[model samples]
Target: MKFGDIIVAMSIIAIVIIIIIPVPKSALDILLSFNISLALLILLISMYIEDSLQISIFPSLLLITTLFRLSLNISTTRYILSEADAGKVIEAFGEFVIRGNAVVGFIIFLIIVIIQFIVITKGAERVAEVAARFTLDAMPGKQMAIDADLNSGLISEEEARQRRKEIQREADFYGAMDGASKFVKGDAIASIVITIINIAAGFTIGIIINNMSFLEALNKYVLLTVGDGLVSQIPALLISTATGIVVTRAASDTNMGNDVLKQLFAYHRVMFIIGSVLLVLGLLTPLPNIPYIILSSSFFLIGYQIHSRLKISTEEEKEIAEEAEVEEVKSPENVMSLLKVEDIELEFGYGIIPLADANQGGDLLDRIVMIRRQIALELGIIVPMVRLRDNIQLNPNEYVVKIKGIEISKGEVLFDHYLAMNPGTAEGDIEGVETTEPAFGLPAKWITEEEREKAEVLGYTVVDPPSVISTHLTEIIKRHAHELLNRQDVKKLIDNVKEEHPALVDEVVPNVLSIGEIQKVLANLLKENISIRDMVTILETLADNAPITRDPDILTEHVRQSMSRYITKKYTQGNKINVITLDGELEQLIMESINQTETGTHLTLDPNTIQRILNSLSMNVEKFTSIGEQPIVLTAPIVRIYFKRITEHAIKDLIVLSYNELEPSVEIQSLGMVTLK
Candidate 1:
């Protein structure tokens, strides 16, 4: 048998084997689909370049395999490309055709093309979802700083900031997961429906044109039959059914239902009608000499004039613009605005405000306290104002006072997450994170020597800027430490755990554990050693490690700490739980829960703890079990955020603290802080 025929037979045998046992169905499906896709990819490339016959041989093999595998729809394939498409070349040359004739060939072509589109959409969504998860956490953290200002005292701005974070923490947690959901529902579905409509439409139009009485000569030129393909290639005929299923299923989703309407209303339907008219005109004319270029140019000129002279936008543009604005509004602006004051100027979160406006010359400690309180009340979170022993340079314009995150009030500080150093930096000073443009919010910050090593390990930009941050990490931790120490929930979780499981009081709730210890406790919790005692320990640790509100270096350290702590677990062992971890708050919650558990004692958190955490988490779907095919990056911030969310997970639609919260070094601390940041 010829190699092409042998390949065809082998392809058929593989499909049959897959159907018979079905042991690794998903893997098999992916492989089968992927192979067909690759084959079609080669064919399209060759045809696009007008490759020689030598190169065309590969397209045949690929086309044959795909046809035999039935991985593409035959008709949708007909519509996507022009006559130069590789499949058409096979017709021109008459080398081989398995399911001979225009109709069947096009149908198979549609299946392959549709399958390719589905794969592309699927891959794009998966990558985007992952990128979105990261961007969501980073962006909202910036917004939490800004959002604190917009709250009209409905809650204490600090409360607003915290609440906003709570909301974002949930959103980011879930957005990560939701992106994947949309891929299945949105992108994949659009492909399927688009394919089906195009195919049905193509056949209907094709038949009608063939039947028109004036088209007898044209009908002879156009091939249309379901059986007896060119060259009598037999192998493809046997397995067309399976290929049809794969291509159809892969491309199909309900999301494309709307697109069908769009096609009908706009380009496709018009094109079909135009083509039919021209075909009829061509057949009816006795002179039989209608130039295609004249027709095309005339149509083009008419379209351009209509489109240009009107200078009017239809509902579509309005809808698209509205959608774009919505997206922009939804994404958080990442720049921090620096406020200029008589005594000192500093970069704050979102908008800028002068320290002078807030009262510049005050007792040092009192000024720090005022800044802290104002930051919390205005931004719904605290900002630390640490007097760095060694002043971090402000360079007449740059520095970010990022205390875990910054919370600014409504004052007009205009530094944004995105900024540009207007005049390109002096050559010597090009060492920071440079901005492409500042008008839209991208800013130029110089990469610091320390941040370079850090950026390498965790994908963070290590650029420096010319502004001072109002709050330092130490002050933030100190302030939050106090609030968290005194938070009603923390108090409640502690007291409840102590009361319900007395032995844990000492093992879990004694004083506070350092950030390092909290890290350990979190790692252990993920290992499944969750208990009330462990949770208390984590809370105390988080409270301790939450950067001191007045220490700059401490604040920077906190972000690093948090990122390092995000929970990332791979599910190689039988679809185990994959944590699309939340930012820091959620992870803090998990650590808090586990840290509360005691060694050598019975442990249980009140149902309220579970419920509150669950409620806080439900706003975003990324908080719980991971159900996707994605590679996870388990960084500290991500872990510190999502680890705590494990407790709030719903089991079969009912919420319960996951039992895994109480097992071994359930406290899995992957790293030891060799040196404190």
Candidate 2:
């Protein structure tokens, strides 16, 4: 039976004493409590003995308690039942067991108190340990997910690596904090308070049912129970319940959706409702037998309905949130807009930035914005973007600045100007060459045999489509001028080659000589009838042999140039490059290389290997009779012009190149000397 039922039953027993034995309320209250206590004690003892002795004592215990109660006359039992004292006993007993849950509540309180006392007295170090344990339990696969993202192109390889690291790091950090913080500021506090209150309430409730049976002191605000040294103070119970519920509601809200808090909040809700109704109904109800059973069933149904209602309300809230999110996506501007401002620190010029403009008043975020922009203008940055919070951010590895000062966030392209010019300039920037494509408006043209011949005859650096002296010299300068123009490096390099191939040196020098020697050498030494076109080209070939670029950059000699040359020859299929469909002279050259390949060619004609694949529509040819003209680029959809670099010593390496690269690659492949590192 519930505490309320027990209280009501006890009241009926009180009236039984009043009629059959004729005693005062206080004496009757003691007699009834003693009877119930003895009954409970006997029930527990019986269960224990029967389990050990192999005999059932349940019936005997029940009969003994029943016979004692049977001694009361029916008229007296009905009188006490009318007084609501029976309700109080039944209600109190049920409350003490169910709502009060004295056993569980006691243990929970002890644990919380002990933990809190330890935490307060010493420290809370194990909190992080506890949190880490939970985080470990929640960890997903360490690297495979990120690798899949990278391999499938969901992210770049670098980004996938970053993402994997980020997830694992975040989970670990969050787990540690979660486990530790939950108990410190969450359920542990509530458990200790609830336990003390409920235990005291139960005692007061037991005594109150005893007093309320007297009928005289039945006032709402008065003490309802009077035992040996205890009394159920109705006013105190009400005050405690009200305070506890409000605090509980707030605490529960705090813990909601929080992994740690959710567990704690549940325990609080379960205990609170039972404890409250038990104490109040026990000594108050005036109903007899029918009311007790009906109220018990009603409480059970209501509790069920309350649980359902909370769940439905939570679901509705989630639906409303989802709807709001859908509305936000329809507006592109809203989608692109940055989240609200957090914190801003402005910088200006090369020194400590001055706070020139002060915001006197405005929203906190607005003031921050005004001050930051004002400072940025002082520094001469044209368009200063507000830095947004970088949460769960992954670094773009493809475009990292040099290693000297690797600030991943600020860099876009891997080329840092400082590093390209003078590497190791500062921390975070690494040393690397930043090669800019000359393909913007026009690529500098190489002087062909006709243009260079014309330029040498005309005595000036000039070129047409077939090429010229000046343009060719500039091309040579670009490749070899990293060392000073007068460095003798190119000359010495050319001299060494000339010892074996004099004609090659003669073809290159007159068009491009060191600082002040170009005109004199050309005029004095018949730099002869050598076509300046072939001359510049030969010099370029020499410069190409120079060790300017080295790995992790490139080195034509780092690998056995002979072996590299061998592969180039071995990979070339037919001494003619083929353009799958285009069988022109250019196409023939490409086919020659493909046919010549003897080593295992890893390049497959798979769908994955093809990008922007199509066929050529028509042939395009541009004729330039003079210099200073644009070379036209013809596009034909049906024409298949793809890159082919037989380097990387691995045919599979072509996977990283772009569509434009294939054309140059095919050209390089024809040389039978190209090597990529």
Which number leads on TM-score? 1
Q: How accurate is candidate 2 locally (lDDT)?
A: 0.33
Superposed Cα deviation of residue 130, candidate 1 (Å) = 18
Candidate 2 stretches with Cα past 4 Å from truth are 1-140, 149-162, 167-677
Q: Tens digits of per-residue lDDT for model 2 on 112-215?
A: 35644444312332443444565476556445444333322346545866776666765544444334333333333433343344434434443476453322
TM-score of each: 0.23, 0.20
- What is the Cα-based TM-score of model 2? 0.20
User: Which regions of candidate 1 deviate over 4 angstroms?
Assistant: 1-289, 301-310, 314-471, 484-534, 537-677
Model 1, span 1-677: residue lDDT tens: 65897896786676555434432334533543454455456434433332122232332343445443332323213322212122342233222332345445545645544444455435444544554465466775556334433221224446666756555554453354334334233423443454455434434554474343324322222332211122112222222222222222222232233435434444433554565566556567654546753564455555565455335556668889999988876665522223422111234332222231225321223344455565444323223233222123333232333232343111112232322243422233334445442212335454545445544344333322212232332233333332222234344545665675566444444444333334343333322222223344445434555434413223323433332222212122332433233335534544454432223212244666656655544433342334333322233432332333343246222211222222222333211111111
Taken over the whole model, the C-alpha lDDT of each candidate is 0.37, 0.33
Global Cα lDDT for candidate 1: 0.37
